[model samples]
Target chain A: MPNPDAGGHWGEFGGRFVPEALIAALDELEAAHTAALADPAFMSELDALGREYGNLPSPLYLAERLSEEAGVEVWLKREDLNHTGAHKIRNVLGQALLTRRMGKTRIIAETGAGQHGVASATAAAYFGLECTVYMGEEDTRRQALNVARMRLLGAEVVPVTTGSRTLKDAMNEALREWVASVEHTHYLIGSVGGPHPFPMLVRDYCRGIGDEARAQFLERTGALPDVVAACVGGGSNAMGIFTAFLDDASVKLYGFEAGGDGYGTGRHAATITAGQIGVLHGARTFVLQDEDGQTIESHSISAGLDYPGVGPEHAHLAASGRAAYEPVDDAEAMAALEKLARTEGIICAIESAHGLAGALRLAKSLEPGARVLVNLSGRGDKDMGNVVEYFDFADRKGQQG
Target chain B: MRAEAAFATTRAEGRAALVGYLPAGFPTLADSIKAVDIMIDHGADLIELGLPYSDPVMDGPAIQRAADQALAAGFRTRQVFEVTEAVAGRVPILVMTYWNLVERYGVDRFARDFKAAGGAGLITPDLIPDEAGEWIAASDEHDLDRVFLVAPSSTEERIASTVAACRGFVYAQSVMGVTGARAATSAAAPELVRRTRAHTDLPVGVGLGVRSGDQAAEIAAYGDAVIVGSAIVNCYLDSEDVPAGHQRLAALTADLAAGVRR
Candidate 1:
């Protein structure tokens, strides 16, 4: 709930574990973040950008069909309706603003599902700043539409072809690029995962989701929801919605991790559910590592939730028992996605579907009238290709729609 | 040969020490040990045996390629000590690795096993002084040297704190980038070394981008040691066969040694 101490230790999880060359830059970023938070002009500018550009205060819509199915009230915080069709735009806009404050002209980022990359590219285009995004070669293929979207937004997308060819490798490549260009380029980390200020910084930027949702839910129902749920990868969206409810002990929070095949199969990205404590991508957190501390490649049908490590704050939250995390396997998440599309006519990202699956399961255990809010983190338009392949839509009846 | 003694020996000869690096299982574990032997036999004053990690964010293309091959070939953390113990009698051996490997290996346990294996210490690229409390305690308890890095971007206070935690020597990163050979050495190296010297009497070794004898000689003029990695690793990677890698590694070591002595 509080900011990390001087050395960025969030109960011994988040610290700057990076090359000496990057220490100065991280320190500068931390200082700038501290300064910007206190500056009224900066805050006002960000708020205006959120309203005019990012479609701030995304709608909180009641899903009557989902509620009836779960025998409980269900509401969807529609972050999918935001600019760039994901929660990532909030963090990108915040970081892009900081990049300007730091007097940097170029920004670089790493992406998994390409939502973050596209959001960053969009922000860069708005600000007329140079942008480059590093995505794993595999993800570039899986999310080719998002890749093209980034390029069309005037950002160069570099395909990282290292170590598992996924989000982790893209981050590794971004760090490598940042090391050489630290003086003039800001590494606009897209998640609440990396070193020191990143986990805290990105979380703060995206916390608007929870802030607006909390107010709207309270205003509508005269009380908070019984549960809040979101998918956890690097955990930004989950953190974005969870932070506001941390103090409301009655409101239980759940983070659903991508369980590719299942927990037993060893081919999952369920870091908190099945992983051990270790360091990855600059933060000491729950990591899926081999016996010798080598990072094991994580598998997930949802590219956004396929990372082998979760955010440090989420690790701390899990360790402290403030929130519970569970694994939602590929089949369960896909089924939930199908249900949402059929019931509400809302096709959501596969990553968000994990949270939907977890929420549906949790809702069954609660009192019949208990309310649950799910963070729909992104739209499914970019995932149309993957969805088509998975469901084999061409073979299904009424495929024309 | 302990770290201080190794540097002292070269200091007595009025020359900088030549510090050479190679991953522990590149090519193969046996060939990597053989390569180290060839390096020492030729003229490497010290050895920094690399433990190829999965996410080597600080490595350049050459080292990344070799590390990838090493990891793919099933190289693990324990084999680093095997190579160190094999070559420790020839020169002081410092295991260069990321912090996660040591943390996962257990800090006290790693220090104990490494010390028992006749290894000198660690050169952790990611373990900056701010997060080095456990490592500092372990190294001290085990009487092992700890080498921390200083960079061109390091503030004066950071350099001082980094050197203060170091036991063997201070590593000065020549450039603001990952490790690889460059056409020219950094223009910032000399100033960084001078700043680091103001904090501690620890010998400063300049690393990153030094490949040729000319570059080695240039760094030797100011630095206490000249550290090279990618070029030496490239010797094995670019060679047609393992024996030829040994030949190329030995020749390069001798050239670097001559440059330091010049």
Candidate 2:
């Protein structure tokens, strides 16, 4: 994994910039986490749960059909094949273990993709903790199935209507809730973002994606993959897979952010590409902001990639030149999503489609045999409604040929 | 009209300093400006003019809703300067905001504008001293006060660092929650105030969960300045109309101000 600077910085990007009310809670969380890290019982229990509950070692597969189209040895890290159909399960389960450790019986979370919400609900159900999820009203409307899924899993889902009503707002509500309910609740942050120890703590739990990918890829390819790529919102999976390759100088990493329309159109969540360095939601990172230092509303077709800010570690990686980021426009991402399903029978989430789109762009310059691995972050089930409406699939299908 | 001067003046009067907060464009910029003047007339010694950013994580629903309305109404950062410039010198004013709004607006330029507009200092809810080397240096250059927060959870080392970095008074939290009024005063406030005073002779201001005069008086016993945010905003939030909100707010400010008198 890439070495973080002291005090939770990825460089100058990550630090705990939160209100006074949250500091004590963050300190308690950090102290508890530090002890848990050294405690073998905690590790064993977490590992056991990961194996039995999350179905760890999500397979690494070579996409023969995708390779031919891309003209590179394309591979897929099957995070989609995990328990929740995304990499989010890894994080929430770990946090659930920590919640139990801290003796916090209530759990709260913020979600954009609904993957994280579903994962949090799953963990809460497993542990029998009271679960409440804050989701953007727009996201709830787009990803209604996930909202139902969360409710089915025994979580109360709150639709936040404030400020563009997306991931950023949901996160803001979650932080507000955590501040008020810190005495009895644990805020299970879904990404490798937020303030001190959370960014680091989440990274610790989430590194398994990269760790498994590294071992699996090395065994199959006899060397590290030439490139590793994943879609970045808060950058949990991207950082998860990228960490395993951070120390390896030769293996390049890429994080593809959602360009909702395009960068120039001001409707996108391309924070690393279009954002300036600043603080948002507890951590100092790259954020989309107006010249006046106020955060701007970010847009994305994929709710998962619709955040105004990205993880601090991603900010540090970009600053340090360890990883590069690119923006994949909404149209381009959808096209790749369709292409991947048609070519390889893998209906990946639109979030993962951004990575596939970027990889396709990357393939045009590389030789046919060169290896590329993409974190297929999730399945397309929750996004079907959005996809259908966005593409006008039903209307088009209803029309006569 | 520096923050320290306001606290010192209040101490001389045998009362806890009454710090009032109003988000820059709540209801409207003109009304908010007029409202703060009324608050000052009633008894507010210091004003924390809130810059309404899109995500106000530290704020409660009342403040958050107000901020959302303000931002949605196109309350720009420059408008904060307008509010400060119009209301400055009447009372010591600090722009209470998150760091990103200041950073996205260049730190050097932000401090310069705030200072030029007669802003006494910043009460940054998010920016801590350790990560604030740039802000510290910039504030020093601009001769603006830097008010950092000290929570009950603050470690002794963290307290020392915050006290050293702060140029004005240290902002102490009365509770472990976002800004809002509560039924009872925080049990943790007195000890936190005593703990902070041990480190520095700088006046410690306690904020969060303070609403009524009874609550304010209890906190004022230990806190140098009792900061009221959500309670003040709730006047606007719960009122039938803007004018009523402003009127109720003025009355409440006076009530709280009287309670601060020893």
Candidate 3:
């Protein structure tokens, strides 16, 4: 794993930029995480849970049709097939285990698309811990199905109406809730963002994606893929799949951020693409902000990627030139989603479609035999409503011949 | 006026200092200045002029509403200095803000500008001592007090380091929550204050609660200063007009000052 410094400084991008009240809780969490990693029992238990509950080693499949279209080999790391239909379960399971280790009885999570909230709720149900998921009021309206799923799994869904009423606001409310209830509650951050230990911890938990894929690809192809791509909303999935490739100098890493409309429209969540370095949520990262440092509201058709800030490690990677981040606008991402569904019989989330879109573009530029690996981070079951709206499925409902 | 002088004067009077807070441009810039004028006239010994930012995670609805209004009225980072300049000699004005604003404004530039405005110092709620190296250097270079906070949940080691880094009075979050006024004061404040007292001789200002005069009196009994934010902001939020807000703000400040002195 690419560990941050002792203070969780990922090249001056990540640190404890939170209220002093959260310091003790963060310290305790870090200690518990360190102890948990060192303990064989904890590691084995987590591994066992990952295998049994998450259905580990989600397939690595070669996409012949996609490859034919792009004139380059494309491999899909099928995180979409995991339990909860996403890669989110991996991080949730790890944090839930740690919460149990710390003797916490309740877990609170902030969700934008509700994928993480559903995964957290599922884990909370499994562990019999009280779960409360804070979601943006706008997101609740957008991802209503996931809201129902979380509630059905015994989690209270709180609609945060504060500040822009989106993913960032949801996180703000979750942090506020964690402050008052830190004694017995764990703030199960959904992404690899926030202050110390969180980006590192979440990345560590999700690294199984890259670990499994790298070994699987090596065994199948006898060489590493030329490129690795993933969507970068708070950057957990990207970090998850990018960690194993950091040492592989030959492998190019591409992070596709949500480009809501287009770059020039002033309506997008392409933080690294068009943003300044500032602090948001907790981590010092690339942020969409006004001239005075106020966080500017980011827009995206993908609710999950509609956040103003990218993860700190991503910022470091972008700065150090280890990884390249690009904007994949909504139309292009949705087109990629439709292409995958039509050609491969696989419908991936709009967030994951961004990675696919970027990968396809990269493949088109590469030689025919060069292979690109795309982390299909989640299935599109939760995004059907959006897909319908975006593709105008309503207009053709009865006209399908 | 500086923080030390404010505390020293309060100590000489054998009373806790009354620290009042308001977002610098809430309602409007002119009205905000008028409101501060009313507060200083009513008995506010120190002013925590809040710089309105978009994401204030540490604040609750009362402060959030006011901050939102301030931003809606187009409050920017430089206006914090404008407010500080207007209210500087009246009281020690410490800009209570999130760390990002100062960083976005350029740490050295922010310190230089704030000091140039005749402001006392800063009360950064989010910037802890561990990540405050640049800020510490800048504050010291500018001869400004850097106030960091200790919460009820803060460890003794954390408190020691936090207070050691603080040049102004140490800020103590009486509760383990965002800033708001509660019907009851923190049962945890007295103990947290006691722990913080063990580490630093600086006056510890307890915040995150204390809405009423009685609550201020309760905190003042043990803490060196009674920090009232949302209560005073609440008066403005609940008022029918700007003048009414000023009137209620003054009344609340007077009541809390009297309670702190008692």
Candidate 4:
């Protein structure tokens, strides 16, 4: 329940841990964002773009078959149905509008799953601004479709092969790019993470997901669900959906982190669950780092969830006991992903599957008729190739032979 | 402070000090040690030994590459001590690091171990004054100098506060960007120095995009010291032969040292 200080500290967890050169740029961004939100003309423009371009008001659907199988009603806030097939568009579109407000013409972003990059590219195309994306080389290979999607949208993609060649390193490279190019460029961060204004800004833009789902759930059930769940990577969708329920004491927030091989293996990205609180990517939050404070590599089968750090707001919420976090392993997430596709016929991204898996478990503990809401943050189409490779569908043969 | 001593000596000589940088554990740990020695022997009055990190947001491609190579070669926090021990008594050595390393290594422990290794201080590019409670307290406990950076975009209030927090000379970034060598000196460098100077009687060192001797000389004319990193890192990174790179590093340091005298 603790709010961030005026200087952007989420109770010693979130501060501008950047060079002095970037203070001016972050100040400019924070000021412009505040001004834009306060202006009716700007807010209306952003809302119009959200409706026209991003296909806002993402539907909330009751997964009937899933409900029957689990003996509990499960509602899905379908962020997957957004324009870029993910919740990432909400942040990008808002920041893209902010870029114009700041009188900048260039937009840069860092991506791991490439969902955010594609979203940023889509916004840039709409706004007629030049776009560039920095993706870790490993992520580029893992999320090839999203890379091509960004490129096809006319955004230049730079593959960062530094450090672990993952999301953390890609963000470092993106910050470097921003420092040199801050005047004419806006770094369109895609998560509820990073330095000030970004985490808050991204959350504000995405709160519409929670707003819509809350209304839809109310109309159908006449009450809020007992539990609301979402996967946490850099944790945009989770923050988005959780924002609406912050004041509702009965709505228990559950954030599922990626437990790649499980906590014992030290290979997971379950930062809040198993890692220590430290600064990374400008935010002081739970991070997987070495004894020397160097960030350790994080592994996740779901590219979107393969990050070493969590958002600072989530850290504050966790500290206040307003939210509880759990880790869902890769195998569990994949099982839930396959199950959702089979039962609901609505494929879920591997990242969102973590939440689905957690929901399934939470439902068993609750009353049989209890309701649970999950944020389906992205579509599964981009993950089909990885799923096939992971389950070895290409190698599986019919037993009849 | 050792940095103050070096600056005093240089000022007495009627010249701005040549501040050199080299990433610890670069090329190889052993070669990195030799490189630092070469720089100090050639002309550097102050040494900024980079503690190689996994994510260096403030660094450009060259320094990042050097750090990546160092880290790839099994570098860790202990390696910083090793390099510092090897280069002790040559010049006032300041470990240029991002804040995470200190936080991870435990600020008190890092300061103690560094002081034990005869290190002068730390130049934290990321840790600013307002959020620098731990570093400031640790430095005081260890009696070690703590350097802070100021930029062209720094407000008067910021410059004043940053200078107030600094023990050594104020690091006045030449531009509003990360570390790298530039084709020409930033137009904002001299003005940034002037602004920081207006805030404090403390010496001001200019950095960010300063590459060649010509650029160093221009910065030296107004600034108290010229801190160069990516340019020195570039020497070893681009050289086909590391020994030649070592020679080039010394030669470059000598050239910059001469420029500071102009």
lDDT of 2 at A15: 82
Candidate 4's C-alpha runs over 4 A off are: A1-3, A395-401
Better structure of 1 and 4 per DockQ: 1
Instruction: Go through the candidates in order and give each one's C-alpha lDDT.
Output: 0.92, 0.88, 0.91, 0.88
After TM-score superposition, what is the CA distance of residue B187 in candidate 4 from its true location, in Å? 1.6
RMSD of candidates 1 onward, in order: 1.4, 2.1, 1.2, 1.9
Cα lDDT tens digits, model 2, A49-163, are 8888788879999999889888898899998988988888888988999999999999999998688999999999999999999999988987788899999999999999877
Candidate 1 vs candidate 2, DockQ winner:
1
Query: Which segments of candidate 3 are over 4 A away from where they belong?
Result: A395-401
Better of 1 and 2 by lDDT: 1
Q: Tell me the tens digit of each residue's lDDT in model 1 across A253-354.
A: 999999999978988999999859998888889999999999998999998998999999999899989999999999999999999999999999999999
Docking class of 3: high
Q: List the residue pairs that clash in candidate 1.
A: none
Q: What's candidate 2's i-RMS value?
A: 1.6
Query: TM-score (chain B) for model 1?
Result: 0.98
Better of 1 and 4 by lDDT: 1
Ten residues in a row with the worst lDDT in model 1 chain A? A392-401
**Residues B86-132, model 4: lDDT tens digits:** 89886788999988888988899999999999999999998888779
Tens-digit lDDT track for model 2 on B1-262?
6898897788788878999998999879898899889889999999999988878888888888888788878889889999999899978999998888888888999999999999999989898887788899899999999999988778888888889888779999777778888888789899999989889989999998888988889988888999998898889889999999988987999899888984
Q: Against the true structure, what is model 4's DockQ?
A: 0.80
For model 3, report the TM-score of its A chain. Answer: 0.98
